[model samples]
Target: MKQINIFSIIAAFIGLPVLFSSCEDVLDKKPLDLIAEDDVWMDASLAQANIYGMYENLNYFSHWNGDPITYRSGGEGYYGWDYYNSYNSDCQADLYWGHWLSGRGKDDTGWTPSTDFGWDAFSLIRKTNIAINHLTSEESRNSIGVSVANDMLGQVYLLKAAFYFMQARKYGGWVIVDEVLDDIGAVAGSDESAAQKLKLPRATLQETYDYTIDLCEKAANLLNTDAPSGQINKGSAYALLSEIALHGAAYLSYYDGINVDAYYQKVIKSVEELDALKKYSLVSGAEEYKNMFSDYAYAQTCPENILVSQMNESYGYRDAPYSHINRLLVNFGTALLNNNINQSFQSLDKGYSMTNAGAQIQPDPQMVEKAYYVIDLDRKARRFEESQLFAENIDIVMEEDRWVPGAMREKRKLKPTSSYTSISDLMYSRRDQRLAGTFVYDGSEFLGNTIYFRTGGNIHRDSYVDKAREMGSMTGILYSKRVPQYREIVGNLNCTNPIFRLGRCYLNVAEAYLSLSTPNEAKAKEYINKTRVQHGGLPALTTETGGELKMIYLDERVAELNMENDRYLTLLRTALSWGVTDPTTGYPTGEKGGIIPELNRGNNPTKKLEIEVPGDYMVEEDFMKPNAYFYREIQVPQSDHNFIFTPKKRYLLPVPQSELIENENLWQNKNWE
Candidate 1:
């Protein structure tokens, strides 16, 4: 799901205030002047430009804003709320953090500040409609226009279906806006109809789901992946239809608190279609994977890549952890690479190493814990739980005034001038191999010289690079993936963003298969082994995922989609009674009791946390110890009121509150207070 983030809007709105004009009307202008949809959609390429804009806006959302790792990575993102004292990893913390009152009335949480990603989704729907309305003008639709309009319109619906589905999942109760809002005009004061029109109430989850699915089917008939990338083709449309059904079913199943057979059927049907599509196949090769993400993939696209985001050096504003440098800063110079301490950020505050590590998102243990249970028969050779998720083992102890992993190699290898770190090279050690692919670990050969972190290099954290003297065994992990790949080192015309690849299809099929209950171990094994064979690893690695095939879903997903913005969705897939507790209400309208309320259910030990930060650093919501209200709270009560949206609703996002107010037919999500 491509989405826009606050960063873009920030850039958009930044230059507005600087201008000082009286009545020039210069500022009151459209981004593209004179060329409105009236003339644009009439042409094929211009219509495509609009689509490109939509794509640009959505990429950020997919990569960062809506990205799971952005929240759960290293407990830096929202996923690791427990890492932050004020909030915990529990879903309740999210609701509390996004409190109704706090989120209401123009505030960012509700609508005022509006999420860029959220807007991108709705805007995409609106933009697509504009394309349709233009194409279906009385003139066009009247003269053999039905076919053309239907084709384009089908694509729009497919895109919109995707839009609404995302909304339903995020906001639960969403407002349905079938068309664009040309203008808000003026807000009518509190009259009965005015009040109703001004504040769109949430639509029933059922309505949102029904509408999205309907649109998907309508689009499915028109789209074919073989169609040019610019248009929604058959492959894109059908795959999306399948995606909506599968995701919709999952969302409904969890939120409705009913394991409806209908939802399962939806998934099965879509899976069937996905199986029928013949345009995709997974790509293999470290270089191939790397190049697959570049523009170079077009000619050599893996059979797996069905839909890919249009990427280039510029012509669009957007941006990954495929960082080789930041990984260095994190590992603090372990393995063969020395720490990449930005001397500029170096401040000798006594002995504390304090530099606001650029927005590091960490994963919450609770969610990571669940991934272990999503059994997959494909990749894992060992049975495990979240307990198996090997996070960088940070051991900040008072002993020896250091956090050292008592291993002789670790202790002897510790950089003499260093500060804190894990006994095991958490950031760069043996873990998801994706780490190696996405990061530049110390000692790993790169360039003509050793690129790993070193003790006394400019990359070190020393206040002054020249003064930095010691050089011990380097063990830092720096990621430079999304970093601008300069043209001097890499040519641009050959780069492409690895948008929609085939790996996900395998997972989608596996998940659907698991949901079927009678998962064929042999079939599951076949899929898992096939994926591994691509990586040149044993085909039956996931034998340990589960004695049966149900356990391998999450593991296989992790192996394939790690840090690819799927982690959060993976958790949301298990969309638990996910909400905040109101001391006043037993469990709100729809939510489950959580945190201190017997959070884990059984022998499952309650979650605990111990974050390591610089001595003077205070715990923030995304970087705190476990036990904050959410971590310490109890499970949400399981009841009707506890649920907000239906499973179908999970697939779509609620329409923005402001938009609903302007549209008479639109309404808000029912979950609204």
Candidate 2:
């Protein structure tokens, strides 16, 4: 495997005008200073630089910490940023109140096709077409070696398909533009021949899927089997194929002339092909699973990463100081782990027990309640013990008009306190290990600091006097998933953002199996249990079948790939699976359900547990008192953040108004028009 400094190459090619402009703009005015089209094909280094530019273009559209879809999926919250502050995907989904309050929905008068919902990646697609045209030419193959040309060609095909897939999943179908209309001449022509040449009608949703799949297959055939991580390879193509096939199986079969079972079979086949390569595996053990997203994993060549967007400090690709992930999630305290999602992880000791109907039975709520009380008592006892140690060992000092714990004084070393034993630990530690790996609650340790999200505690929203500083977790939880633990400062934090992995591929297979016309329960369970046992450190699932199995599978996806997966798409597809109907047409809208109805409307009310703090902190006798307790077991009134899913056809995005005006042949998505 050969490692390419792709970011460095991208930096060098950053000044290219063709990569940044629209198709019309690119053709209308050719910059004299830029590299000539003919010269790019003749020189291998310049051609590779063009390809690297395409990869950099992907970052603008790819799902990462900064992507709106990350917040839209209800996987994580976004705060501090002016646009999405204190909002998540649930706002659009009607799971919360932000969309209505902010006037930002599809039906809002201010809504425009130019917004985030519009399709704008055609420029990237056109760039790929240019690359593909030149790379595939016989003259270029003679100039650049045949092997290098083929590899570059394979990457462009994948890139073009990926750009289309991103749009297809959001907008259903896009206009097919495979050829470079180089001979169309300047757009300033009075005849308007070049402008008319570009105005192609949109392809159907089914056709879009077919086009994406065909390109992925071609990429798989041409891509290197052992390409390094972050680079597109055979595995990348197969993984993408599996994803598109699964989505097509779920959504396209409803309206398009496609068989659901056939699409499912396609998903299975793609996964099987990728699996046969034996190129990647799920990172094993609890710590390894957590480290899979850290710099440690990036340095050690994490087996889980199939395709990644590599950000390196050495290449000047560091995260922005003000808006880095750690600042958003921890320092400025913008994003929080959703409370409902935090409570969804299954207990590690528990295995599914079969009911009389052959469905798996879950743990009783009453038993869970009793366990919570028992854990609460233990937590209080531990806190008292820790408070005594802190009082005896550490000194209290006045810092900036506030009483704070002083750093280690002289000979007395501060003992590690039991601050780690909050209700979160009792609730989470014994459950799926992935929960702790993904979220930091009241007592969780992060970056060598004890995080306290409880009311009146350090990281709580109420602790800040300045309104601008009140950006802590509203849900009493913060996301730790893919957040590096080694770096205290995040301005220059370098890490790989995973795009595809084997764990997700396994889930894709499980979903396809469970979704088959004749649902393969046994096969689905086997695939689900692989992640459950290995990544989650949970017992192997047994006897879960039918609707129960489907429920378990959905839960598994949330636990294993919540932040990473396109969860909004998953929810939409699942709604279709459950026979949710379209509101306007009253049709059984497959994979497009739940978006246009007041369905799955729920709230994520902020919860604050009342903990009784002893007065006169310097008094040792206060800790020695008989009734000195830590938690009062009283919960504050829940904050109202209820959901209201607007009834509109927002399943597919509208074609950009600007694009539609420019190309009159183009049509808007069904509901948008």
Candidate 3:
């Protein structure tokens, strides 16, 4: 027997009141009371406000006080919006390891179908649908002015399509609901039950993509070419369309009655349209590229940002303070740079490579001594300067007793010494400029602090032994990409979260070219080289076979978009393209395909280095010896690798068990039942 509809169940849970009241009672409200539904459409500003409510769902970070708008809804703890990205990175990507020993890794059997997908943004879709219905009505168009109504409708369409796109990429096909429905228990005028009206069957994967594409096109047509910052425009619509089409093309064989080539062409075409607008370009220079992601004010005017989620200092404070990207990475230790990512960056000469082979060779003793001397000199100078400044700024006051000192005032408090001279800096020097911009390694300067990831450093250290297993970068490096470096306070960062940018668009076009039937290697090389040469500060790629070029493209993507949550998605898409089959049906899973079974676990060896203590340096921790020692990279022990293999069914998350129970029409993903 059919059960309740998922939307109706969600509606009841969220306490969505009846949207419309009787016409007779509409005028009974006072001026300060809630505006009637009819009044909302009559005013352009009210209609615009209705659309803006949906924008709240676009933020990737959870609110300070654990606002339930973006991700899972428990306090501002582990269930924040960044949790899903961190979870995926920890389990799958080569850029991170979520401490497999603790059972948070891919081999953890505790992960199950009951896990929250965190992309159930249907509530946003419902709101968008309601707004669409209002904005498209003849009365609304006449009252709010046709131009205003069309613009609002454009935003609504983009939002509706965006919500569907998020779900479709994860779960494939979904139930399509374009119209608002009555509450589950609302009275029905017809003989048909309200449950029957609400129970909609899932559409085919092909139909879902087609409908989403249509909505994107509609939005592109209605939206203005230019929009205010943080608002949707034709460029945003086309950028999203390009991304959606790229995913469709990746899973080409899974969809019936669809041409994979056509999807690729669609991606190219959408990107081409966005390019024709002549509004965006990749930010030049390494500093500019870093600033594009790290600085909020720069991002607003940066041509690279086609779409971005505007964040501010105020967002960090609410009912309960929410953690921002900086706090999550530094304070909570949610993710760290998996030492493996360092190899992706090219050296300044573009010929010398930082690889495992190079890492195995020990540095010359003379060079090591020089590095230590420079490190010590710099540390001593900084400390003396800090002490002098502190002495200059303090004001001693008399207390109640004798001439006792009161509260001493200082301009700025210096960060604790977290660095000791290490040989790893020699290895990292002269590599890609982006490496320094993206990660905080031993001896790196960040926000007036020398960040240390050494074994016994002050701020943080690599935890190998069980007793020292505290919240720190287990991989000996912290992911600093897109993290605002100038924020003096941890959670006060006001960085803009980039949703879509020209750099990604160029890569999408390049990937499409390489993925075409004929394989346009030249075209692919051209598009990929734009960002590689401009942002990476490296030479343009040379000629190569389609397959070789594809490999190069993946590496370039990793170098450019590593910690931006693109690695996991790219890995999944690559698996699909390799003809990986669905676990249950033995069909091509497309973008939902799992990585190679042998490579599913976190197998990247953590890096470590051991160095002799220079002078009279004493470690604060009693666990360390006062004598010689330095840290270097080493493989994790085999005993720690005792993880169960990930089941194939985990590639695509299961439709929430709660939804499955409430809506019998909703089916579990393949192999999930």
Candidate 4:
């Protein structure tokens, strides 16, 4: 084997992660026929190449940590997965995996092997195991294969563990496997004892935790510690260890019923090493801040990211959510313009029923208002005012920040970072920098020939509104945050979707140090202050600032890593009970059912059908008490019914049933039924 060099990092960063570009994207309906392990891994270079493919597999969006809720964006409606005809579903609580039926549903568990998602989950594990055992086979034992084999095995182990973690989070516990147990052999057993023995039961959470930790450690030992990041670097080992240990702590203490500070300590200690690596920091100020998220961030992971998934910018190649199509797909929802003299509604429901109708996942007034406060009030001048629905959020710091309407996301098109500069200081004042990177207020130089749902392709919003006098009256409020002034040629930009970033590491270090301060006050202060200094954040130990390690870090984290980062995952993993909830508008629980009346269908000019607001919706508060279930942040739809609907259990996804049926030795986790 050759001596490792800086080029090793370069190769891992650029070349290797792209190895399985077309082959590994999990969303591909067309699957790739994998190469047999015997044909590869015999030589060092080939083994190295295969390792890249495995890493690429990890980059798929389906491979990352996921959120439970999908937002309705404009706050006008709610529906996704379950009962969301927009997606697909049986509308049944018994089925856990479907587009409309959310990971939110709870019912009979332990899915059968034949279900669709279960099949997908099964394939992932099977693929991971095939890679795992092949690396351990005899052909891989020669001088070249040993280290390569170990690295491969450790990675597959980590991925397997990570996969199960997703399942455990969703299904409570899940079926797990280590060796590449063959399906045909398990099924071929003729004797009653053999057949009976092949059937598996559920494994305990403790057993899974121990298995994950061991795999991480073994992978750490095999992969050279100083190796570059893209290909399972030592940092990856530490990351998995930290995640598994923290998860273990949560499971044992909260679920399996045992307190394990030792596990917490392990996570903290592991993360400390990553912190010392000096490759990351949280960007300070609004300009460098917004710039950190745009196309400028291409080929770069912020200093704090442990692992990152890079997008292909290829059509249908990247994760479905990160694609250019979703971001700039023409307004195939409703028509915005018509030649009629009045601002008539050009009803163009694009080729679908309520299920297939077009919906711009715009940010609700609530999210925009909070973002205004956090960005405008906390940072600069006011830009946009709070809409009437959310006007009370102005001074209320404790209001639950709404989950981001995922679709109103910025294109990061060819706009300057300072595009968020405040003109109307009253509107844009006191907010986080992330707001500017994300939204396009009135001052932005927006290009449009944007396609309206009523019209087909090659049309612009400007042309429609200006030429079509009837539709000119409709303004920003119509699309709301969905149609932010887009700047780039929506089709050509090579923007890569960031799946993981290093910036959160600073946040991680900050959180750990802050939490530690309660007991080891001095030591905690040291670590906490160090992170702030490293990031050029507000200084700690200041007289006016209270100088308390915990509070300082908490404030700094929200300021530096706001919306782009998953505040929810960080909060949940840490077992921190924090997140705001507001009752400004009362939710539509079943008690209020039938009172709001069903949505009406008509295009009557005199007989109007406007939206109705709940009568108890307008009380305001200064701060909201965090709810128990929403430990950090759990996203919810904007609809009234969703506000009343509680989320749990179905919150996490299950291990697809395929692998369970195939691997005889692996047992199913408990209570999925």
TM-score of each: 0.58, 0.73, 0.70, 0.58
For residues 1-673, what per-residue lDDT tens digits would candidate 4 score against the true structure? Answer: 0111222333544634433434222223222234444655566665566545444434322211133122122222232321122111111211011111222211223323233332134445655766665577686667465765676676666666666654454454555554333432242344445534434455677776776677776666666554444555666666667666755665565556565666667667767776565544555544444444443242354544445544433333223433222322224223443343122222333231111212222222233342233322332222234332123232222323232444232111111222322222323344444445444432222233222211111122332433321222111212211222234333333343343444544344444433332434455455544534443332344332223333344444433443332433443333322111212321122221121111110111111011111121111110011111111211222121121112222223334466566656554434233
Model 1 bad stretches (over 4 Å): 1-41, 67-124, 136-138, 141-148, 179-201, 229-231, 294-300, 314-380, 383-435, 446-449, 453-475, 480-496, 517-526, 541-551, 575-673
lDDT per residue as tens, model 3, 357-460: 10111111221221111112222211112233323332233223211255332212212331322334433444445556666665676554565544345334
Report the lDDT of model 3 for residue 447: 53
TM-score ranking from best to worst?
A: 2, 3, 4, 1
Ranked candidates, highest lDDT first: 2, 3, 1, 4
What RMSD, rounded to one decimal, does every model reach? 12.4, 12.6, 15.3, 12.8
lDDT of each: 0.39, 0.54, 0.54, 0.38
Q: How displaced is residue 74 in candidate 2, in Å?
A: 22
lDDT score for residue 241 of model 1: 58
Given candidate 3, what's the lDDT at residue 40? 76
Candidate 3 has what TM-score?
A: 0.70
